[model samples]
Target: MADTTTGSTEQSTVPRWRIVGPGLVVAATGVGAADLVATLIAGQKFGYTLLWCVVVGCVMKIVLVEGAGRYSLATGRTIFEGWRSLGAWTTWYFGPYIVIWGFVYGAAAMAGTGLALAGLLGGLSVTWWGILSGLLGLVLVWSGRYGVFEKVLAAFVGIMFVTMVGAALLTLPNLGELLTGLAPRIPDGGLVNTLALAGGVGGTITLAAYGYWLREKGWDTPSYMRVMRIDNSVAYVVTGLFVLATLVVGAELLYSTSVAIESGDQGLVDLGVVLQDRYGEWAGKLFLLGFWAAAMSSLVGVWNGVSLMFADFMTNLRGGTSEDPDARAGGKWYKAYILWLTFPPMVMLFLGKPVWLILAYGVLGAFFMPFLAITLLWLLNTDRVPREWRNKLHSNVLMVLCALAFLALCVNEVRKAVVGA
Candidate 1:
């Protein structure tokens, strides 16, 4: 099959601990500084009252990612290929989406990395740091292969795991409260935070890119199904814990004082200052480093992963035959999109984001998660995939829940963008 990996079926028997492939890539890519701020703001606002949403969000991503991986393995096709099979309308939606989302997200991701660096080293302006970060991401992914990219991303995840969780521990969470947080509850006026926690934070276009990463990792066939499940489950569980740790910091450190942070990415920078004031300088410096790692990882991951998706999209749009993502990993289209992600968006850094562009980015960005959930429901439940590999009842239920949740989030995102709220 065009999509089959070169690896043998026996490879799946390797121990679960050794199975940390595309799952980690997807997870790290999904959790950027914006996600941290979202969770941090949630913690600031509602304390642990919305903690259950973290677990729910993790499971939601797991199901969506697993369904995406399963479709690829079972059908020996890419997710883009699966989407194409649905109809030309899928192409219409995806074309505009990938273009606009890439343009806006490139600038946002670059600026995020720059913000962390500016916090870490007070010498350079954020605009220069942001431009450098984009250039750095381009340099990192422009040449390296998948294995090298994965290893770099793993290092970033290590920094993310230690620093965020360390901050949580520093706050000395209330054990009783931590336990109580596991119960589902929503505070007053927390409806948006509740939905954002469940659907938005630590997830986005990267979840669907799981399949592309799988192909790159040589887990491209159904024989690796068990391993894929293990990878997906373990990665998101870690992400959930990381988020829980962020909430702990919010609830234990900031919530009690009723401190307010500047909205958006500046909120995380505000956190570094608090850490410095309360725990001394090392804690603050470490958190800043971790923040840089998180932002840079997302930047690099998108530089690689989304470019792969765009490559596949372009190839399919040209009526090209099915091709393995790894086969075209750094091909012309991949390189072109990488350049697009790196350079053109830099203008936004200096001139500031245009209101219309921001609106398009928000509305389109909000629509994507629900789009993936609904389409996966369509693709996996039908004869499009083999009956044995089709979504089981539990899978169907989780995906339905994901669709509904994200749809609510979609409405909220659009409303907020439209009104500048």
Candidate 2:
């Protein structure tokens, strides 16, 4: 499968610990503040009963991401390239999906970052803050240097881990109950919540960007498979820990109390205020900072990673391969998407998201996970990837389960969007 389209062949001599770039970027990017809020809500509603779901979510992500990385390394191809090999239909599905997904997601991510900054600094409109956040992300990713982008994402992940996990520890949750949460007993009336927490933790379209990051990190050959697997596992384990800690905070801090918070990003602000009143101002501010880190990390992650994917997609759209200059980092298509993610979305900040746009975004977004799962299953099982890297029976089982799980979630989301519309 090695071909001229595959780029440089530099083998990684760095130890596994030092080879943690793309995995961390993908993992951090996947766990935005919204994910934290979902985990918090899970804890609030069901206490430790659904902690097992968080673990399940993390495992599922690891499986899917690892499959993506494995395919890229084994075949020396981008995920986009693999999808194209599937058929022209994949291109048709992805083309409009990415455009719509980006416009909606850009606004959502910027707003999320703005909400965090507004909560932390105060005295500023969230819309303006969101605009500023989008601009900052633009500048950061516009450089097109993967090394710098990875480091920035790493710093943000550090802040998020410290603040969130620290807050959870401060709550001093019961170890016994936390352990029992691993037993997988769903509480009464907790089906949807259980599915969401199990299937939704740290999940996003960015998971598909793992292979791009792996290529950027120079892990583009089959020899790097073990390292890729290790990197993916470690990264999601950290992701799971961060998410679990947030659950602890919700269970100990909110579940036991009578305090009620609103839904969405604003709910996080409400929780921060509760922390201030109950645990003192410092605790609240720390959580707010963590929230900002989560949001900003996601912004940076998507800005860099998705732009790379878009570049690859554009290259393939024009009959060029992943090795085309336009598909690489700092290429024209890469910068173009950076601008798209930054500027156009700012309009939503001022005009507010249109009802139709929201409906379209929701409908398109609902299909991405299952789309990714089904594609991965197909690409991996076929001759597109080397036989050595083909999905094992266990892997195939997990992929099938992942597909079914995301399909169910997709149906649920579509139902909500249609009903809400």
Candidate 3:
């Protein structure tokens, strides 16, 4: 494992193509089951009319993540460290948020993986499969080797790329309509859905994890900025393709057939069955395999990534800096959060989730993306980041739009949570 605090990979000399590790991790982690369903449902409802929003969403993520990576390399501080520099309020918000988010998200990720697996291998029920999935994720990330972790995630991305893109090709998308979808026009009554497709799908807390992965990969200094940008751009380009292919599948197959999938992760399992009925059992099975890969990639990525963030949070809160041994990969704090994300959530798999916790998770989780965007706008523009690395005019513009869009989405999320409660 590359030491997070020590070691160097020659940033300038390394070929451009080789600088593609961390971004893949973020992309795979961010575009999980819920994201897939959001895009899938969008395509089913509006066909390709919402395709432009997918492009907008990709650019928004790239901007925010690049700001995060740039701040890390330029200031040589973790994102949590940068946040702490602002005020004590940052600590108060993040400390509780990470705890609650991990508890609920753990069960959600596990159930998503279990759903796909249950459809594929029916011996175990979804609850048992979910427990098994959580255990497997725990084991895989326990080693805390970023290299091994990245490789495993890449393999999942390969499966996702092949299966998803193949399904899109199988549907034979109409070239004229596909091209026309590029024009930005909202269908009547699609405003909320458009906002969601633009800012919600393919986005998550993992965007801020880019810097942590970059550090683990030995790209901690400003010299790595060029490659960091390249890595982010290229990885999200592939992610953009993945999202587009998914929307293509929805538009061509589901829309044309007037078919609608059940919402949530189960929608994906339902799609697999549709593939089986439309094509063959093999097509459906392969799609389910892709679905599992997507879910597991997210599970493992968060297992590794957010645990790193939580380690930093704990270290900082305790007066230790980011370089503290407990804050680094495989350290005590890192492993502690991994346990938090894995084991406690199993109780929810069998016993129902407590209402108070769900309410907390919903309210807190709703604010995160907007919080991230607005904070990046504040952090990158300030003197904390080196002058050369501070956000440019266009970067600031995009981030402002990101902040506003996410704020709207956050309001919608909070409303749903409140209504459900």
Candidate 4:
């Protein structure tokens, strides 16, 4: 499994700090504005009792995402191709889901980004910002290659990491309780909440986008595996800290204040107000700005990364190539999905999401992580990759745990959504 980049081997020597590439972008992309509000609410409602869940969530995703990148670099094959080797059913599940998910998710994500902007601009409504942000994503992705995209996203990660963590530091939380959160205990009635937080913290279908990002980053070979591992560890470590900081904010401010936060983006807005009251107006504004950066990073990330994913999916379906031409950003299939993601779903914005569509998205989306885990478990262990690069016993155990966690979380989500549990 190897790739020859556009330059000589000397170009491969990236700086340690600048090694934050696709993994960081994908991880940042996966954690949306809504997720921040969710984590904050969880912290507020339960204090840091759920903090361990965030760490678990990061670990679980690291296994899955690192596996995805390893599979690609080790096999010299696209994740779509790797999945195809498993069987046709992989294509079937991925095809419609990518299309439908792209349509609905584009609107939802843009709206989420827009909500954060609207919070900043007191008079502006979300719909206007949603349209603007969508167009901005379109233009940025349309104009740049993967390197440019990675740099911009990394900057956003910096903004998000600094402000949230800085605010958390200011609160001066109880160190003892914070340390206790590392012990992995589930508080009363917290079983479902713990699972949800564990599954939700920086975990999303964007994990699949890792391979595409790896390819884009020129890490398309087995030698890049060590670098990929380092890249992934650093990315998730940053994510873990961001999640911890959110937990700290929840524990220190909302928990003791008895502040009740609503679900969705408004909860973040309310949290911002709470920040203003406690830390000062600038603190609230800064938090919201950071919140917007986090949300928009995810937006730009998905807009660019997942569009690459859908392009590959479409290319594979038509028996076309995913490299050199069709797979590049601004290529035919990539732009097509970008349009698919940005435009058609606007109908949902006004008409309200059709119940069936919502159900399908939930059912399909809920099971994707399990699907990814199971597929990678099989794909990586096979001759598709050299034995040396294949999963060791310890890696397999982590993946098995990932599969089971996703399986349980999927069942919980399905039942909860369908039966109103």
Candidate 5:
């Protein structure tokens, strides 16, 4: 409830719209290739029936991300510092999770970016493209200024939204069926798939990265809370629309055709081929390009945003603060974590991820959202934040619901990974 935009000569001097900052970056970072593929698969199999899930996904993200930004502005503490205040249990879980998650995620994100590029430029190998994508992200982030990085990310997001959303418009699906998708109903064999699609859509560990980006944007106090909320709401509305477009395309074109999409990014490639063969090569090419933009933007977003999270993790774990020289963005610990996220993971690209490493990644990845929700539940309720800035009854209830929903999905994720179910 505090106004971070207060006590500012710049607020009166500068243009009001210029305040759009890290909220956009964080939202863009949250939607990657996997998310797009999930939407595409939902569209392909269920038509617009799963469109409601996209809406729910966007709402869930808004709650979690807004919570992140709120905590930072309210407490003037980094999420790392906030988590540590709760108890050692947070730091203990986060320490291993950050390291292991980074190692596995780097390779996966690079490959997704690479896949999109390879599809764009015909006959190129995915591995080389992946490396190129990774390098490009590294260079942009390494530049060390938040404004420059945010603008670059914003440009990529523009390309992705325009192209993908345009494709959906071209499909021209029936408005009646589209409206029906807004209803929350599940069909046969859809319980698990519905949950997965609902949970997976627009959800990622990157949700927690919002606060760090806010700090980088200098929206560090309660005055910017309203601005942050508006920014977050607008960004996710765009995201929800983009995902809805994918669902529309899937429902209109593939539902009755007996054309099944493969799981993961492969399904998107399948979509490209079908689009090209059926609608013309240009359609295929445009979708693939948009896909690349989505994938690469996410890669850069994660590489940049999550690196901030990991950096803060190390800094806070060692009891550092926002002012501690070693804890700052360009400081030793920050750069060190960035390196850990980038280089070591390249080994897995060649040698294949070890079974144990993959297991650890899956188990930890499964619980990350719930971990965030539960921690936010505790953090927001605690005396650390000013009483007025604390969560209202509605916010707490939504978070608790978000926590339970994600926890149930986490159990399912563990079961799937462990039992190969």
Candidate 6:
């Protein structure tokens, strides 16, 4: 991998169209099974009425991610370094946040992958399949190189694109109604759901991993700025299409019916069954395959991207630069986080996620998007980023909108967590 510490002073001789590596990985990693389930539920509940929210959500992610990528390329500094520069509190928050977040997220990702697998090919229980999925991710990430990892993520994205989009097309949605959904309107009692669908589309802590992926892809300078923007925009466009397709499936398949899908990843399994009954075994199987791709892509993406972040965190905590060997992919700290994301979470699958851990995950997870949005608003506006590369007036407005949207989400999440506890 190229050194992430120093900006390449030399301009790239390569054409801009050729730059599409890390963005695809980050976008794919951001939209996992949970995102699919969320979109599907929105479609099921409100049909195409909230389709505009999906588009809005995609736009929000594009702005947020672009900010992150621009910070890295313009400053040639890791996001963690930028965060640490904010204050000692940033470190205090991120250290515990990552540890708890990874511990909970690993098991969840594994279970999600396993659920999809079990839905497609029966025999093993979801828990066992989840354990197996976790192990598979661990091995693949442990053994794979960054180039190979990107290729793997690309393959998963292909499968997701084809399967989910294909499934949506099969529904033969009403074009007029779909187009009308682009108009801003909310159904009765849809305020919360609308906010959620808009706020939650294609978001996760994985947003922070974009810069790390950029560094891994060797795009580490202001010369790569246009390419990074194009890459980010194109990737999110693909993501928006994928998410929109999922909504179409839900709207067409379940909107007229009284069927209710349970929440969480199992809701996807329920949707698969619905597809099987409504269409055929083949249709259901295809959806399950796409589900597996989505889950595994997240697994691999997190395994690589967030592990890179953790490595950097450890390096910075020790006063090492971003260029430290321990902070790069395949370094000891990087591998350590991969192991951390893979192994300890398996216990949660077998024994059930501890109640306290679930609560902590909820609270921490709630804070992250707001944390990211607020920090980006701060980082991109200051001298931390080059003036020319700083947030434009429109970019600041969108980012402020993003911050408010996510802060609302954070409040909702905290309320739900506390009430449920």
**Against the true structure, whose lDDT is highest?**
3
Please list the C-alpha lDDT of all candidates, in the order they appear. Answer: 0.88, 0.87, 0.89, 0.83, 0.79, 0.88
Going through the candidates in order, what is the number of backbone clashes in each?
0, 0, 0, 1, 9, 0
| lDDT of each residue in 258-376, candidate 3, tens digit only | 99998899899989999999999999999999899999999999999999999999998888989998999999999999999999999898898899999999899889999899888
Tens digits of per-residue lDDT, candidate 1, 1-421, equal 0122344455646765669878989999999988888888888988889999999999899889989999998898989989999999999999999999999999999999999999999799988899999999998888638998999999999999999999998888998988898899888999999999887546699988889888888878788887788788888988898889989998988898898777788888999999999999999999999899999989999999999899899987877855844336778888999999989899999999999999999999999999999999999989999888887778888889999999999998999999978
Residue pairs whose backbone atoms clash in candidate 4: 29-298
For model 4, how does the per-residue alpha-carbon lDDT over 296-371 read when each residue is reduced to its tens digit? 8988888898899888888877888777578667788899877877778776666778888878888888889899
User: Considering only N, C-alpha and C atoms within 3 Å, which residue pairs clash in candidate 1?
Assistant: none
The local lDDT score (0 to 100) that residue 275 gets in candidate 6 is 88
RMSD of 2: 3.3
Write the residue-wise lDDT of candidate 6 on 152-251 in tens digits.
Answer: 9999999999999999998899899999999999899898888888877675788889999888888898888777877888998999999999999989
**Can you give the TM-score per candidate against the true fold?**
0.96, 0.96, 0.96, 0.95, 0.95, 0.96
Superposed Cα deviation of residue 185, candidate 2 (Å)? 2.0
Lowest summed lDDT window (length 10), candidate 1: 1-10
State the weakest 10-residue window (summed lDDT) of model 5.
1-10
For candidate 3, give the lDDT of residue 396: 86
- Weakest ten-residue segment in model 2 by summed lDDT: 1-10
lDDT-better candidate, 1 vs 5: 1
As for lDDT, the candidate ahead, 2 or 4, is 2
Candidate 4 residue spans exceeding 4 A from truth = 1-12
> Lowest summed lDDT over 10 consecutive residues: which window, candidate 6?
1-10
Instruction: Tell me model 1's lDDT, rounded to 2 decimals.
Output: 0.88
- Give model 5 RMSD, 1 decimal: 2.2
